[model samples]
Each structure stands twice: as structure tokens, then as C-alpha cells.
Target: MQIKLIAVGKTDDSSLKELISTYSKRLSHYCNFSFEIIPDLKKTKNMDESTQKGKEGELILKHVNTSDILMLLDEKGKSFTSEEFSEEIQKKLNTGMKQLIFVIGGPYGFSPEVYQRANQKIALSKMTFSHQMVRLFFTEQLYRAFTILKNEPYHHR
Candidate 1:
């Protein structure tokens, strides 16, 4: 299955971008992986939070295909251990999923429409993290999950 990570905005920190790139490359060895950045909305100071989210949601939805299984990285979503995450990925592969899209929404979060279209939601941690930081964390976790699946000593019991 192909795994795509769609996130809003660009990463400004060179250090974080480098780290994200590193993990993304490692992840590619295990699957058809891609990380896409949807440019942040311009002149958002004038727009209300809801409107900004709605606009961003449109862009987010545009990237999604009906056949793709959409998973949102939401704070209130299900949390899993490394092993469980690997199992979840295995289940998707077993079911013959074509594309798995995990989205990280904009500053104010996802709109109602986006929520409705999502097949599942996953939470990386209870602690709050910057959207840009989350990109690195998720990619690293994905790489780790793949290593764990192959019993490569990347994850512990």
C-alpha cells in the first residue's frame, strides 16, 4: 500500500526539515511513501478561525481521492503503542488498501466536512505539538513502525 502524509504549511526550521527528510527517506525503503505539503492560507489575519479552517479544508479535500483511506491526526483520536501501530498497518495491508492518506490539519484544526470524510483518526501523543514538529514525529514513527514490522531491532518490547 502507498502511504501519503499530507500536512498544511511549510517547515521553516532547517534542522527539523532535515530530520523529517531523513525519516521520510528511511520510510521509503519499506513502502511507496510520499510527504506532501499544502501551502498555508495567505492573509489569514482577517479571516475568522472557522473560515480559515473551511478554506484549508477545501484544499485538504482536493488532495483526497474517493478510493483513498483518509486518516486524520487528531488529538482526540485513538492512541496506540508501537506494536499496535505496526499491527494496524498490517491490517491495512491485509485488507489490500490502495492508498493510505494521513492528514495533519491547519492551525485551528479540521472543519466538520473533513471530519465526516475521515475513515479513522490517530493521536501520536496526549501532549500538544506544533504542526511542523508533528511532521517529523509522525514520519519518524512511521519509519520505526516499518522497522518493527520487519523485526529490525528498531523498536523494543
Candidate 2:
């Protein structure tokens, strides 16, 4: 299955971008992986939090397909160990999924519509993380998961 990570906004830090790129390249060895960045919403100064979330949700939904399994990286979502995450990835590959899309929403989080559209939700950690930092962390975890799946030494029990 092709795995896609869709995050709102771009990472401005060169270090973080480089790290994310490294993991992304590593991931290509194990599976088809794509990282898509949605441009940050324009003219947010006049909009309320809910309005901004709604607009962002609309953009997020545009990238998804009806057949794709959408997962949101949400604060309230379920957290998994590295092994468990690898098993989940294996399950998707075994099931012959076309695309597994995981999304990181905007600063205000996802709207109700986005939440409803998601097939599942996953949380990286209980503590809050910046949107940009989360991209790097998530990419690393994805690489780790793939390594675990392949019985590689990159991940340890």
C-alpha cells in the first residue's frame, strides 16, 4: 500500500526538514511513501478558531479519496508502541490497501467534519508538540516502524 502523510503548513527549520527528508528516503526502501504539505491558510487574522479549522478541514479533505483510509494524528487519539505500530502497518499492507493517509491538522486541530471523515486517530504522545516538530517526529516513527517490520536493527525492543 502507498502511505501518505499530509500535514498542514511547511517546516521552516532547515534541520527538521533535513531529518524528515532522511527518514522519508529510508522509508522508500520498505514501502511507497509520500509526504504532502498543504499550504497554511491565508488571511487568518480575521477568522475565528472554528472558522479557521473549518477552512483547513476543507483543504485537508480535498487531498483524500473515498477509498483511502484516513487517520488523524490527534491529541485524543490512541497511542501505540513501536512494535504495535509496525503490526498495524503490516496489517494494512496485507489487506492490500490502496493508500493509507495520516493527517496532521492545523494549529487549532481538526474540525468536526474532518474528525468524522477519519477512519481512525493516532496520537504520537500525550505531551503537546509543535506542528513542524510533529512532522519530523512522525516521519522518524514511520521509519522506525518500517525497520521493525523488516526485522532491521534500527529499532530495538
Candidate 3:
């Protein structure tokens, strides 16, 4: 199955962009991996949090297919070790899923509609992280998971 990470806003930091790109290239060897940056909402400073979420939600929904397995990277979701994450990835591929879409929402988090549509939720950590930083971290973890799956030297047991 193909894997895609959909996040809001572009990475402005050159360092972070380079790191994310490095891992993304590594990931391509194992699975079809790609990223989609949903542009940050204009006039967000004047809009309420709910309204911002709703606008972002619409963009998120547009890219998702009905058959895609929607997984949200949420603060309240379940956390897993790298090995377990690899197993979860394996399960999805084994299930013959067409696409496994994982999303990292905007600053205000996901809308009610997005939450309702999610098939699963995953937490990277209990601590909070900036939306941009999370993209880098998540990309690294994804690369590590694939390495673990392949018994590569990049990941340690």
C-alpha cells in the first residue's frame, strides 16, 4: 500500500526541510511515500478556531478517497513503539489497502467532521510539538519503521 502524509502549511526552515527530504528519499525504497502540504488558511488571525479547522478540514477531505484508511496524528491517540508501528504498517499492506493516508492537522487541530471520518488515530508523543517539527519527526519515524521492517541497519532493536 502507498503511504502519504498530509500536513497543513509548508516547512519554512531550510534545515528541517532538508532533513525531512532526506528521510523521505530513504522511505521511497520501501514504500510509495509522498507528502501534501495543505496551505495555511488566509485570514486565520480573524477567524475563530472552529472556522479555521473547518476550512482546513475541507482541504483535507478533498484529497482523501473513500477507500483510503484515514489515520490522524492526534494528541489523544494511541502511541506505539517503532516495531509495533512497523507491524501496523504491515497489517495495512496485507489487508490490500489502496492508500494509507496519515494526517497532521493545523495549529487548532482537526475539525469535528475530520475526527468523525478518521478510521484510526496515532500519537507520536505525549509532549506537544509544532506542526512543522512534527512533519520532520514523523518522516524520520516512518523511515525508521521501514528500516525495522526490512531488517536494515538504520534501526536498532
Candidate 4:
């Protein structure tokens, strides 16, 4: 199965970009991994939080295929240990899924419509993290998960 991470807004920090790139390159050895950025909305000076999210939601949905499994990185979602996460990844791969898409929403979070489209949700931590940081953290964890699956030295048990 292919894995894709879709996040809103551009990551401006060069350091973070480099780190994310590093993990992404490592991930390519195990599976087809993609990081897609939905550009931040412009002309939102008068738009409310809900309205902004709704617009972002529309764009987020556009990339999804009916057969793809959509997972949201949400604050209220279930949190799993690193080993458990690797197991979950294995389960998905076993299903022969075409694509497994995980979305990182904008500052205001996901819209009602986006939530409706999601197949499930997973939380990284109980503490809050910036959208940009989440991208880096998620990428690294995904890389680690693959390493664990392959019994590689990259990940220590």
C-alpha cells in the first residue's frame, strides 16, 4: 500500500524542511511515500474560522479517492505506542489498500465535511504541536515504523 501525508500550509523553517526531507528519503526504501502540501488560503481577512476550514476541507477532499483510507491526525483521536503503530501500518499493508492518506489540517482544524470523509483518526500526543512540527514528527515516526518492521538498526526497541 502507498502512504501519503497531506498537510495544509507551507513549512517555512529550513531546518524543519531538511529534517522532514531526510526521513522522507529513508521512507522511500520501504514504500511509496508522498508529502503533499495544501497551500494556505489567501484573502481570508474577513473569513471566520469555520469558513476557512470549510474551504480547506474542500481542497483536502479533492485529492482523496473513494477507495483510499482517509485518516486524520486529530487531537481527540486514539494514541498508540510506536510498536502498536507499526503493527497498525502492517495491518493496512496486508489489506492491499491502494493508498492510505493521513491529513494534517490547518490552524483552525478540520471542517465538518472533512471529518465526515475520514475513515479514522490517530493522535500523536496529548500535548499540542504546531502544524509544521507535526509534519516532521510524523515523518520520522513513519520512518521508524518501517525500520521496526524490517528489523533494521534504525529503530531501537
Question: Sorted by lDDT, highest first, which candidate order results?
Answer: 4, 2, 1, 3
TM-score of 2: 0.97
Q: How well is each residue in 1-157 modelled by candidate 4, as lDDT tens digits?
A: 8899999999999999999999999999999999999999999999999999999999999999999999999999989998888998999899898999999999999999989999989999999999999999999999999998998987774
Q: Residue 127 CA error for candidate 3 (Å)?
A: 0.5
Q: Which pairs clash in the backbone of model 4?
A: none
Cα error of candidate 2 at position 91, Å: 1.5
Q: Write the per-residue lDDT of candidate 3 for residues 12-98, one digit (tens) a residue.
A: 999999999999998899999999999888878889988999999999999899999999999999999999998988888898988
Ten contiguous residues minimizing lDDT sum, candidate 1: 148-157
**Clash count for each candidate, listed in order shown:** 0, 0, 0, 0
Error of 2 at 68 (Å): 0.2
Off by over 4 Å in 4: none
In angstroms, give how far residue 55 of model 4 lies from its true place.
0.3
What does the lDDT read for residue 69 in candidate 1?
92
For model 2, name the residue pairs that clash: none
Model 1 misplaced stretches (Cα beyond 4 Å): none
TM-score of each: 0.97, 0.97, 0.97, 0.97
Best by lDDT: 4
